[model samples]
Target: MTDHHDRPHHDLIEHPRPRFAPWLVEPMLRNKGTYLKVALAAAMINIFGLITSLFTMTVYDRVVPNNAFSSLIALSIGLAIVVVFDFVLRVLRAYFTDLAGADIDHDIGGRVFRRLVAIRLDQKKGSTGALTGMMRELETLRDFFASATMTALVDVPFIVITLIFIAILGGAVVWVPLAAIPIVVGAGWLTRPALDRLSARAMSEGLTKQSVLVETVGALEMVKTSGASRLLGQRWTRANQQHSDSSTRQRLVSTIATTVAASANTLAYAGTVVVGVFLIADHQLTTGALVACSILSGRAVQPLATIAALLSRLSATRTAYKQIDAMMETGSEEPRGTALKPARFDGRIELRGVAFRYPGAAEKTFDGLDLVIPAGQRVALLGKVGSGKSTIARLILGLYQPQEGLVMIDGTDIRQYDPHAMRSLIGTALQESVLLSGSVRENITLGRPGVDDAEMLRVAELTGTHGFMGRIANGYDLVLADRGEGLSGGQRQSISLSRALAGRPQLLVFDEPTSAMDQTTEMQLIDRLQTELQGRTFVLITHRPALVRLVDRIIVVEAGKIVQDGPRDAVLQSLQRPRTAA
Candidate 1:
């Protein structure tokens, strides 16, 4: 609730260090306990994994050469017990890994969603497709944590254990695996630059393709009406091709790295066998020891090979993590302020010496503009298409803050009030009606707690939405398509109006609310709205002259400056007056 602007001049001059590093680490810290448990389980699993080579050595050296059947039986039973216990540990390790991955998914997903919702409207413009793709990247990270790649990473340290065991069984032959370790790791390292570049390009191309498809789907009506389907399809095809090419390149590089690592391990095993044969001939080592040394060499190099195979996925996951981290750090909206909450209040709006501009515009949208509306009065804002009328409404709604000046509601600065509480007192319906896929009753109630059936039906009747509800088979229970696709424009607008009115807000703002309606429907809706909005303050932003008559006063804005403000009749007469000479 602290006003950032109220900080001292010296404080404002000081630049704070970036907080992104800590923000990135916060989620990992939250799941530290689960990660620790997974690590412990992995260590145990790796320790038990050595049993295979140990059992082979014992059978060949102790049982086979001695013709000891009883010893063989005992060894088989003991090894069987070890194998069963190892299997259980592996299962537990996988379970814990999955548990940790799920926790991270839930935690990170919720955090990102909350931040996305709270971001300023201006900041979110035109990035819908990219944002959607970023959300999907979270799934990529979740899968990475749960995949065999993660298991290999955990087992990487156990490579040392395998090498040490080999050295103990056969001296100096272990040097072959020791020599191959650098080759295995170096192959992966050498391919990293290519993998990073290709993976990054592929991710960019994939997001572009996704964005095109999302845009096409969202504006299908426009594409159909304007005959742009072919153009859009061709554009998507190009994007898809680029994405596919990048993916192919990335896969090729990853495959080469994996092959190199695997080949190195194979060569190391061959070297160990040749050396062990010489040692056996010289009476320096046993045949069982040679077998154990080969097995241990493979184990020593397997982790590096696994890592090489997973390089592409790891690179993609790294890119996603960095992108999400930057978004949360810089793109998220500031926290809301703490302010008093009131049940209801008179709707008095004031804008004092306001100066504003859109995010990327060169010119100001408004400069030194001032306006005042008394409580419980209806007013209309008349302006041309791009004259900043809608911008004013957004400011009043607290969706955007003025670059300079103050916007007050009921004598208190809007910034000083709890934004949610302030918005709850106002109702709005825009030109484009937004409706989610749900039943008719659900759309009307909008999850408001105390809105009973009667209240919902009452608002429906008030907005004339009930007229179409009865035509549908399920009445209030009738399901709607995504974004109200099945309904006519007027029907959609009516439902949106019903939703706005259901709240009975003290202040009602409509921005060309009836733009989609036919003339007759528009007039009927205006008449009904007039009665429903009685005793409440209303602000209508519209170009229609007919709609202006419903308001008590009219304010004309030209070039972001108010040209005229007076009673409804006076303003109308002035606008109607014919000019003889310029």
Candidate 2:
């Protein structure tokens, strides 16, 4: 095999992330008529509130002063009707808003997952924890939008009605509410940038803490064994404190904004009444009209007032969107291949100038590598640590793309094949057996299903997992914890071996599978591999030279380049040389 030994190259074209979240917007508009009806109902209720104020001021200012007894009795019935109408509208809005929220949540959540799954590798590589946060943020968004949107929608027509009523009763007098709007907006504007800063800090720290907590729990065993539990706890505590500090600062900004808003509303309300009273005293306006003008002022200020209170919250969520946008825009190591499904893979693997550098890595993992193995060939790869042996294995498995050149099967570029289809051709059992959270049978039959008890038993015995599997209470039905926490390393590896063979793949890639096995178990596995894997190609990366004799050939890699390659006998003879080693 030819070897490449120099230079670094990492360039491949990529598509940009999407800018819109259509999945969410589409569903919100699905029941437009219902939402409109709800808005109309709410408008009616708000109109009643405006009318009530008009009637109250008109009654006291005109009827009471005039000693009109019958006007008071008519006022009671008007007030009663307003109460009943408002109550009914409130209930209807609640029911419809809840129904809408639930439907949007389901549709958007599913689309979010689909988007997440289809996210290009480059898009998944940055401060990627935000994807998890997006799940929660989107749900919270649905809740907020459901309430805020309906109210905001309802306020538009309701607000216009009050303005018109005031104009007819007191010309140009309704401007009081409009005047207060700028003040409310100005107050929020002053605090928006500051709140954004605090919000960014708060969200970052909160997500970091969540990630740390999840990692600590997931690696509880390793943490305990390494005496690093205290380290994780300290980090978690510090994260919590930082989050608290950010939130407190945010609250302080909000408090100031809210105080300023209240002051503005108070001054505006006082000014409106003062203006109305002056007009009344001059006999230019009636007391009844003054009352109606006051009602209109209240209606205009309501939306602005509510907006002032929600200012901090809205800024924080927008800041959160910044983080989310980063995740959606992140780039990852570009793979040459698409998801593939090949009908027949002869299992001839090849590498050409293969090189790799992990995401955000300052230095490359390996470079200038080349190797090849024909179909049905068993090749043992041996090397020192950091020698690019495992990297080569992964390259062959199509998990990592080579930046410099290419990895191929049967001289066909791996990138041209569908990712899943290509991967289906190879079965892998790494040093760390990633046993999923499921029953033994489920784990064994992961890559390929449709296995009956008899077939499962056959695979179990073949991979030396039958004895332990049978010992479990429910045999293949015994549920395993995440990563098979309760199982010994040997047991886990055996089950993983079964999983590899379950699909009966043509190409088996074993990355030091015997790392945790005892000598007897290792020897047995080697024998089984030799017998059962006959006619199947295998790439075994291992440190033990003892097993090098089991394969038909040996390849020694160093510094991402192949140093030695030959037939088993030839490599062994070279190793025995007095002054040199293969």
Candidate 3:
């Protein structure tokens, strides 16, 4: 189950504020107070760590040499008190760190998802599987900030203070751990480029594998019918193998760095002891000081080693951050500033000198195309495939913006109005109808709280949905599987058509809406819509001749140009006239 806080409220998307920082950075910065508290706890905890070393030194030098049991007991009691306080501080540090991370998670995760939904369709990049993989990277980023990795990072600065203490107490021996610091840091640094490269390769392969898996599952029936399993399976196998190899190499490099750091820590401790013993022989250092020096040397380099071990995680996090950041930076569909929220549009659509081509297309779908759709005008766009008939519907619906001209609703530029508000007034059912996993009523109403049972059934009856829905045991309550599984293509179209009418929209645009229905159902739907579309602006794009009954005007398009425009009967008569070769 998802947490309530992770869901972005509707108002957040409807009224977004200007972003000052990267989407993830702002949330972490917002919880700076908690991070500050965690920092303070870390400082106190590191300071308390010195107590153990000091106590050991005092026991060996003062208590043992002087045979003072009373002094030892007092030192032991003081050490116990410090230990208790230190434990509490460590626990508090962990709690504060987690609290800050949770706050960031709640804010940034929801905002990222919101951005994904609001981003312009033209700005979308990558396949569905790749996008999903990128989204999952959020968890890796959150874990980096919230886990023990951050704690290790915070402890690094304290290594300097530890070195200072060692220098003061075990003179000449402090140089040993200090010399090892550069070696440990350098080893980890040297492997970074390799680790980063491997991480990126692994991430890419993982995304590809995910894409193949999603595609296979989404179109399993088609894949089986078309004998594509062997091809897709080979692609999946290749991606998986490549990902595994890259991951293994990445881990190996990271392990080598960690192993070097660990070895340096041990060598630093041993080198300190070996040097301290010589000083002891020369009466320059005491046994107690030597022991204390060894303990402090280990503590100093331990953070460095932990940091080395975390290098791979850091690399992966960086890769994830770059991808997610790019996704969040895409252009959003929401208009800037306080956009007009008109209660309704008069349903007048116009495209003036419009030019457009899809992303990565070789030719323009429209060039200097000018057309106007009057309020309550029922028009049919007649064209063969690839003749830009459906493109006209999409442009009017504001699904895609023309590069060179304006799409106006009610004589006002569509860009000036809130996209949600403008689109709400236009009922759209595309060529491919998609139904989510939900009950029939839920799909019809689409979670609109204001829609009642009467409005739902009325639309269902008009769209001929009642004919098939009545046979289902659950009727309007029937639950659908993913993409309306277990239902025929015609049934899905009926449900989709019903949803379009459920809104009582001012404008209706459908492309091949009845392509999947039988002749009887198609005629019945056309009859019902002929009456239902009384005052609505209707734009129909279809190849079927029977649907002509719903429109009063006919416009024929060829190669992005309007070849003919007139009353329905005249256009039909012109089309039927025999043409002589010139």
Predicted structure with the largest lDDT when compared to the true one? 3
lDDT of 3 by residue, 1-582 (tens): 222222211111111224434677788788888888888888888888887898888898999989999999899899999999998998999998888888887787899898888777776776777777778888988888888766787799999999999999999999999999999999999999999888878887888788889889999999999999999999999889988999999999999999999999999999999999999999999999999999999999999999998999998987777677767777887788989989887788898999998776778999999999899999999998999998888788777888899888899888888887787777889999999998999999987765799999899999988888988788999989999989999999999999988869888898999999999989888888888999889999999999988999999999999999999999988888865322
Q: Count clashing residue pairs in model 3.
A: 0
Give a tens-digit lDDT track for model 1, residues 486-550. 78988998988888888688898899888887898788877877777778889899987778767
Separate clash counts for every candidate? 0, 11, 0
TM-score of each: 0.92, 0.81, 0.92
The collision pairs in model 1 are none
Report the error of model 2 at residue 328, Å. 2.1
User: What lDDT score goes with residue 14 in model 2?
Assistant: 19
User: lDDT of each structure?
Assistant: 0.81, 0.73, 0.86
Cα-based lDDT at residue 411, candidate 3: 91
Which rank order by lDDT, best down to worst? 3, 1, 2
* Alpha-carbon runs more than 4 Å astray in model 1: 1-24, 334-345, 579-582
Question: By TM-score, is 1 or 2 better?
Answer: 1
- Cα lDDT tens digits, model 2, 39-68, are 777777777777787777778686788888
lDDT of 2 at 428: 85
Off by over 4 Å in 3: 1-21, 66-73, 579-582
